[model samples]
Target: MGTSEFMLAGLVPGIAQTLDVSLARAGYLTAAFAAGMVVGAPLMAALSRTWRRRTALRAFLVLFIAAHIAGGLTTSFAVLLATRVVAAVAYAGFLAVALTAAAGLVPPDRTGRALAVLLGGTTLACVAGIPGGALLDAAFGWRAAFWVVALLCLPAFAAVSRVADTPAGGVTDLRAELRELRHLAGALLLAALVNAATFGVFTYLAPVAAGVAPVPVVLAAFGFGCFAGITAAGRLADRWPGHVVAIGGSLLLTGWIVLALVPGALVFLVFTQGALSFAVGGTLITRILRQATGAPTMAGSYATAALNVGATAGPVLAGAMNPFRVAAALVAVALVSAVAGRSGRPAGPGRPSRSRRR
Candidate 1:
């Protein structure tokens, strides 16, 4: 799903040419997917509140696979765009359910590690999937990439079908869930701000690193950093969640500021910036989940919604502006929120205090 969301950027020229649409029009596919995710996360979580985790997972996977197949077979741009949105919605539901299920599988203290393991697949996708799709497109045309995604879903479907059914977590009342979500608003806002900073600069990485290094090399470095950062956060977050986020945010803020002042250092900065960005991001997600014990079923949706909101807004906010400068400013705000909002507080309206848990 990560590949499907990001691969479109590389294939936009081909898609535009084949569909006889302008590049600007073809770009809408990416935006459409982000919008779908933002809208679908909470909506699907609420709608599937009565379903077993296994059932929700299987159903969404089917939708995702079917959408990919339909997209691969379509020639009309409008049809293709519709398929992207459908696939994104399915992906959103699947991700939310998967995260909730993953957390449920672990002991409370190990939640961060479990979430990290699940998110590792997405980070790996950044390292390999985007480039792999580009290669597939180069060799067999853009449609081939979509077909490959559909084929990949088959094994996932088979694997998910084997898991024993488990009841969905949290209260079934939609109003209660919404009220829980409100308590989590501060963490969610910080998440959106952090991602906006990370992705805003990332959206224009090629131009940002114009003379410093080639695009593929820069991307590989950045992806590797993301993987490393998340791995480290998985181990550390359980012990010192606040410190992880704070230190990562500090590094991210510093990195972006340096990039703004010293554009020549982009080749090196990209790797460090990627590490810090995802380190902070991964920690923030774990924090939100840990704080959301009261709204376990809706926890994943809250996190997903926050991320998609940032992903959708970042590039738009950075448009025609100095991306590095914009990223630094955004990170500054996120850091302040993290501190002022008391992101590391042990309890909220629906949660048990650390002392109570003990």
Candidate 2:
């Protein structure tokens, strides 16, 4: 969902130009998709309370296919935006339910490992899908990208069908789950801090790259770094689940700080960004899931909500300042990661008791 959400972002300007509209109006297409996700994620989680995890995943893929088709066929810009909205909602639903389900597939000892793999699906999509979509859009048209997405969904749907159902059981008590999360205030605060810090710099990655290198080369480097970084983080988590959060967070912080200060050294900046992305990308997501497994479904849903909140806020935060000023933001992200690491001691044996005092 995240990859698909982002894949079309690069095309928006061109799309707007083609439609003969303002860039801001063109940008609304992206917003419409996000709006759909905001509406769909929780609703899907709540509705799928009775279904097994695998079942929900397959259903979500089916929806993905349908939404892509809708997007491919649309004519007017408004219709395209509406299709994107529907696609985002469907993607949100898939994400919310899929993570909860994935957690049930592994042993408690390696829950972090399992969650890493689940989240990896999205990361991998970003790695391969976004660039691939861009190339396809360039080769065919922006509409062709949607057709490709629809085609991609066929295999995903089939693969999801083979995974055995492992239901978390009982209808979700979303209200009660929200109430439980209040006890983990420290973790939540840390999550917000991490988001603000990381995104502050990341939202303006393009500009930062432009300052250091040409746009095309910098973007390619950034994508590669993110892809490599996310995969590496997942490996680190599997190898030493306890230390990944700290190691990853620290590296991410350092990377951003470097990129912000030395905008002229493209090679160094790319390496830093990749390393930082690798560590932080894996650490933040995996850690959040680890903290929230007590109410896996609701926790996953809430985590997604927090992610959206961060992504939405990042641009607002970045937009308020000169792009060069973002270096400070990366440093702040590192601090948040460090603090979160301090509090993120792993739970042993059974799920951490929600009733136990934090």
Candidate 3:
């Protein structure tokens, strides 16, 4: 799902050419996907409240597959954009339910690690899925790429269908859940900040690297680094979650500072990009999920929404600035994370009738 959301991103030129539009116009597809996720997360979570986690996941996977198939068949750019929005809905829904299901399968202490494993697929998509989509686009046509994703979803659907028919714990009291999450509002802000920091630089990374290394090569390096960083962070999250976030954020901030000072240094560009990706990947997500105990779907939905909000906002805001000045956005990200870390009031297990006095 993550792969599908991003698959068309680097292929904007090809899509625009195929759809008979300008490159800038094709960029709207990316924005549309983010917008869908932001809107879909809570929508799906609330709507699917009565379904089992596995059931919700399976439904989302099927919808995702259908969306891609529709995308492949569409000639109109508007239709394609609409299909991508459906794909984003499925993507966000699948993620929210899958996280909830994964947590249910694990012991309390192991939930973070389990989520890491689940999300590893997203990072892996960066490695294999998006690149594979790009290759398919090059060899075949843009539509062929969508067909390939539709075909890939078949096995995932089969796997999802086999899970037990257990009920999703309960329906969300969205208002109450929102209230509980507000207690940790600082953390959600930090999550948004972290995503904003990464996307601010990442959205423009191809241009930055085009001046140094070839675009494909730098992107490949970035993908592998993402996989490596996430795997490492996942391994450490169960026992050392705080340390992982702190060290990762520091590295991310330091990398941005270097990039700001040394505009187009190839080595810094590659390494710092990796550092930023590492910081934003698996570790922080796991920690954030762990902080919310009741209403796993709601927590997941809220977190997903926060991330999409930042992801969408970051690029638009950064694009308005001189691209080089984007580094200042990362600086703000680092400071926000630092302040969030300091100001955080811990959320404890179970929903409280009245807010717990700390």
TM-score of each: 0.94, 0.84, 0.88
Name the regions of candidate 1 deviating beyond 4 angstroms: 343-358
For 1-358, candidate 1 gives per-residue lDDT tens digits of 7878878877888899989999999999999999999999988988887789999999999999999999999999999999999999999999988888888888888888988887877777777776887888899999999999898899989999887788995456667777887778988999899888877877888677778889889988888888888888887887788788878789889989998899888877777888888888888888888878668688899999998899888898888699999999989998887777664766878666766542
**Highest lDDT model number:** 1
C-alpha displacement of 9 in model 3, angstroms? 2.6
Error of 2 at 253 (Å): 2.3
What is the lDDT of every predicted structure here? 0.85, 0.65, 0.73
Best-to-worst TM-score order: 1, 3, 2
- Model 3 lDDT per residue over 1-358, tens place: 7777778865787899988999988988988899999999878987887788888988899899999988898889999999989999889888877776776787867876677677767766765656777788889877887888898889988888887767875665757766767655666677776767566666677887787777777776766666667666666777776666666666666666666777666454564466456545566667567777655557777778877887887787778874445645654665666556565544547533224421
Error of 1 at 66 (Å): 0.3
Native-to-model Cα distance after best TM-score fit, residue 246 in candidate 2, in Å: 3.0
Tens-place lDDT per residue, model 2, 212-321, is 56766655665666666666666676556446555655555565555456667555666555555545545655666676645656666666666665556656767887
Candidate 2 worst ten-residue window by lDDT: 322-331
**Runs of candidate 2 exceeding 4 Å displacement:** 195-203, 238-242, 322-358
